[model samples]
Target chain A: MTKYLAVVSSKAEITALEEFAEQKLAKDDAIVLLSHPYAYGEQARLPGSVLKTSFDYLNREELVEIEGERFRLVPNWYKFDKEFEKSILYKGIQLGELPFGEVDVFFRENLRFLRGLSNAIRKENPDVVLTGKNSVAGSSVRAVAEKQQVKIIRYFELGKQRTFPLFPNLTTRKVSESKKKLSRILSELGRAKRGSKKTVFIASRGYLGNLEQELREKTGFNVFPLELFLLRQSINPLVAVKPFLNKKKLQGLFADAFNKYKQSTGFRENMVFDGVFIGDLFEFKLQQFALLNFPEFVSLVDRIDALFQKKKPCLLVVWSDFVPFEKICVLTAKKYRVPSIAIQHGIFPAPIYKKAGFIRAFAPLTADKTAVWGRAFKKILVDNGVEPGRIVVTGSPKLDSIYNRHFEPEKFKQQLGIGNKKLVVCATQPASSTNNPYQMVEQVLNVVERFPECFLVVKPHPVERTEKYEQLVQRANCNALVLQKTDLHALLNAASAVIIHSSTVGFEAILLERPVIILVRNQKRSGHTGKPRLF
Target chain B: MSSCLASVLQGKKLNELKKEMRKFSLERNICGDGKATERVIKFIENTAKKTGKIELKTK
Candidate 1:
């Protein structure tokens, strides 16, 4: 049997990825030696036949005496606050102290831990050691494996291949500008050594809105929304596309697509009502646009020249899925010796079409270090050839609030004003180039209508066309609730079952233990079943 | 100056290098190794004694 060591910093990431990996490894004879930063004395029983190290280490008395086949206690090393402790008590996982200290001290401690783990590996000598890329645990595993000459496999769940390049380039530009600004400021500082003021700027995209204030307080840097850069660049879609495309092909295709799309304004106008149809096309077009607009190439060289004018170094932090930008960032970072960190924006699952020639050929290289939402994404990075040492599985701070959430079905039903009915959450996917979402939704609705005692909660994909769905639901005249701004987790907790067509929310619903039915009709040739379907 | 392991490791020396050539290789961040630390310290002490040097002493 293949023995594997999986380490995750957060419970949620561990929970999601453990289940996913277990399912994949079930067919093969394997035992997973699981380690987490938090104690897993409660909420254990992950998928597949696996041994949890933390669980084994725990004394019998420490195990939560929970009754049920599904319940098991696994040890983890996370220290929780009072409120979190209460929640952990409810869930059954014991909380442990998180090792926190000065960065150098933390790293030395981490290295010491690795030495022991390496010895453990030597004793057990597992065929493979699996971990997230760049995570502390993951890095520790890699370091140990390197010392011991063991095979290490890394995986990343959120494989946004294209976005990796764009960040480096953007950071290079930012660093160049910062260097110029810093030189002038430093020169002024030199002239007036006393009473000179210095300011550091920190900027992030709206995606990192949750961290804006925290980052500001920690670093005493001016925090600005990443949209500021978009606005600064005028959201030049072309600026994003040019790095990947052949110049002539990009220009010709862009002109043709733009003109064709413009002439078909009537069809395009209807897209607001049919988001699926237009969203997929729009995504493809944007990808094309990125290829054509190679302006960043010339600009990057000019920026490199400017960097030579100033002597100070700058740090660039990027988090996004725009691939060309990431490539540029990587190249510039390497060229200028600037430190660059890429934060994983969301759970990035690999494109399902692993066998596709184009996708395989065009896959972009990842960042120096990637911050992942969970172990699921970290695993995805490892699977894609990223070294485990470069991945950080920081639990999605955004979903940290959701980790402790528990909902009562009765109370949820009362709030939604649906009485004594099984709730079905229907999340729609936008139409892709090869799939028609309207037909899929209509088909699923047909199945849903058969169950009169069921209420369907429709959460449309952001880019989905809603008018048709609204009309279809009205025509069926069933107990249907259409929500635009309601929290998905709340709705998911309230649901008895979920129906989706290729949206990622389906997987989230499954993680929440809701039965999900995937509507498969008119899907793209890309081998991805979109989101996993649960029956 | 490269050891056999260094030659096989590619890139730079494992201790000096921060990045990996490939993204999917395994890396770890281990903690809570009092036992292993002691073992390593012992090993170094023995090696230092054998070599007639006091390099293993803690600062």
Candidate 2:
């Protein structure tokens, strides 16, 4: 029986957790941590679990009821020793940790809430800890739990597939009973992509960064793709050997690699313990029975070789060098003597300033030639020991989309029903960076509230739906049109000004000739959070 | 120097800002010629020429 507690995100996850609790948890013997967005938290369906929250033992007056949501917000949530709080916040900053938006708001609630949760976990002293996400706030809680020597079980969902992996470390979490034909996976991606490529195999995780359309304009070749479930960090770890290849022979080849990986003494020597990916080498070593030697990589090599013989692409345009699949893509390309190129997808050349050398040191720069925005990005790659000849400055094609001039600003304004009002576009990125997008809208709403003639257009990041914000808008009683399924550039083109926390839209504003404000509310002093970074 | 100029120009009148922006654009050559993708394609094609065969027609 599992002795530890569980952290849940939503009501839907509550059902899954209840199932998990009933199946594995001891009766009347579990602690719970609910990182619920609303103030109400969960009360109805949770059995044999207790919420390890600030309110669990707090005075009722301390919790402020937030309107329009089932939850309350603690405005003065920094109930801990002030200096200790300061140091924890600074530790987050020193780690180059992204504080979703409003650092003060995030840290305060975390201090009040997670402190209670961590304390409860310490008191319970359970063997296993379960959670939904291992990002940001989850990262903080995991740090607290790691010291207690607790085993972690994470519940992850990829489309219709759900996985429960009791992990020893960050990586090595496998999806059981989920394996698809590599050909079928590739074909599904191609079908979803709908229009393009040169038999060129581009290993990507998310949307192809508009590269496929640009490649179509440049070259007529088909772009067959392979995207490992980068979101889950779980791929088909086993590759099926053909009818003839002796399994023992392949296993023999893998044993040496696995032993070398397992036997590595130093940080740089371990193949699996690379800084970019948090993987467990011990688990990898134990997988010899699953794959006949060389793990699934030998099979990847075989499948890719077959694909090359069939598709015959000129090169590979991989999406990100950060993901593990890029390593496989590069190795396969090297074997076939096919060129591999990685496009810098983000606004900035990665490795947040001080850690420029850290990216060079830790992350695997596997692409033969990195297609970057300009000389600056090319410089970063070359500094990182990538051959200077291999760095090509490919001015971002996504930015090139703005020049297409497809959407009329006036027409877009008319469509938004903001007739003659000066459009103040408030763009919010996905919740990964900012836990609450409502904060971004709140910031814009605050400023737009002052400007009587300004029409606020809340443009949400494509990944998360904005339907949830309708109620928040209704509560705030703000005249805001939360836009969905609209062209961002067209909206940006229409905007008299754009307000953002950290976002790439600032560059779009520059391209579209609009005023942009980067808001980082807290600075290195009195209030805690400082002026924000507008990318 | 560029950021300093932008910071100073932030709250200026629209016409004044536009004039300053026009001047800045003139001095810096910030305008695109719509040939970035073309240049990138050329670079890619040139790079691919080493290992892959391409059929280019005479213009």
Candidate 3:
């Protein structure tokens, strides 16, 4: 009998695996569904199958030392060096750590998943490894399988009815900017209505929460959303659309950027980080990214330069400095000698390892000052080597709405048709951070099943898909609501007890004076709460 | 379900569970008197004035 090890990351992948098995599996074949144990518990409904989870194989932690600084292997933080940062310059100014922000953070969170996956591949030694293509899990699985010399089959979902061996390469397809054009027009309209000589450029209006209105009414300065503001001030629609119109010109521009990067950094010849040949990693990431996205960067640089030339804002504010576009804005503002502030949008954890080079999203302040939620968050930043003077405890402007607005829980519960049952709110973390999101939902559903008095409402992270939660709830035949777009404060207010796996919602739930249960895989991973308090 | 969660939902008083949860201090004052938005505005006003960008409106 051939043994098969199937790896799944998202809930959608579960369905893909089911399809793969239906077409590929024989009756005598043995299968083991390897997942994050808590990620998808009973949802792996293949009968008579052995199951393994990411938690089962998280034994070893790998580190790559570069120039006496130890960095984690998963995020590939060796690329986050000063030399690499200096290479991607626009008009001789560094383009603000472009290649290593959002994606790196996700990798950092999935360190456990990667490590566990590598370990599982070694031990399971399955005859064939099946995985989805074009996912983090898929990429890691491919790397691990190649190293272990295991036969790997990548399953690709084509149309509604067809499963294919591989998906068509659509990278060379023409770029669509229709949505962006509409947004730019809308932004122009908004700016025309509220344009002023004395304007303070804020990040996205979405990040401003209720403060956007308050800033306009209370403060004398006109609040302008940064991208819209910049687009209106600079970037002619014709100029912006020109690069997309000429395919060859766009490719030529990308080639120029790539050649410049290689010449300046010597990355093509000897891009070694502390003895490891890391050139391929850069070739795949930084060089490839700069090549593919040169036009957008060029446009951004032009727009920013024009914004500074035509109209310089008194101050710039962003939700996070580490994010690519916001980082560019912050860096350019600094170059123009304009002050910028990055507000702390999410709660941060204390340093997990005592190592010197644990790359955190908040480290090495890019903005002149960082507006934090509280002293605790500020302390975390300071501990991470940020200057104390640059840290301000402004509290959370987003949380202000929860405190100020009156929420009637009883009426809201009635509206949801959950009549008088003890409401249990489970706010899930993203798949990267949590042990198993599927398992977490399953655990909550099990509790709701046991206690007839309790009703569950699963609130998935903004990044996560709610269909998985709905699927699990349906499978378990439980009375639970998987709400992705409901008012979080109302849900918390209506909840009799709040369950979380290290989310900012836990802090919110605590503030609302609700009973909270923090589900941690172990004590070591409980950096968000300092210590887990399970009551 | 784990016993801790099972116990939380298993006939325990909601007030008592809340009391226990509060015992584990989150170390920092999360939100202070719900005036965070006002403080953010005040910070912006101060920063803008210090930088000589825009004039603040006095209430």
lDDT values of the candidates?
Answer: 0.43, 0.50, 0.64
Model 2: per-residue Cα lDDT over B1-59, one tens digit each: 22322342355555654564455433433224445566666766666666545222111
Stretches off by above 4 angstroms in model 1 are A1-209, A217-221, A229-318, A323-338, A345-363, A373-376, A405-421, A431-435, A463-468, A520-535, B1-59
Residue-level lDDT tens digits of model 2 in A415-489: 888888778777775522222456547645665565566677777765555666565555554567778656778
A255-336 in candidate 3: lDDT tens per residue?
Answer: 6655555555444434433233333333434434544454455556666666666666788888877766677787778777
Off by over 4 Å in 3: A7-28, A35-45, A60-87, A92-96, A109-114, A128-197, A204-208, A227-243, A246-294, A353-360, A431-434, A524-535, B2-6, B9-13, B20-26, B53-59
> Which candidate number maximizes TM-score?
3
- Which predicted model would earn the best lDDT? 3
Candidates, ranked, TM-score: 3, 2, 1
- Name the 10 consecutive residues with the lowest summed lDDT in model 3 chain A: A165-174
Q: Which stretches of candidate 2 lie over 4 Å from their true place?
A: A1-198, A202-211, A217-306, A324-328, A349-352, A356-364, A383-386, A404-407, A430-437, A446-452, A465-471, A525-534, B1-31, B53-59
Best-first order by DockQ: 3, 2, 1
DockQ scores for all predicted structures: 0.01, 0.15, 0.33
TM-score of each: 0.40, 0.53, 0.77
lDDT of 1 at A181: 44
- Candidate scoring better on DockQ of 2 and 3: 3
* Candidate 3 TM-score, true structure as reference: 0.77
Higher-lDDT candidate of 2 and 3: 3
lDDT score, candidate 3, position A26: 90
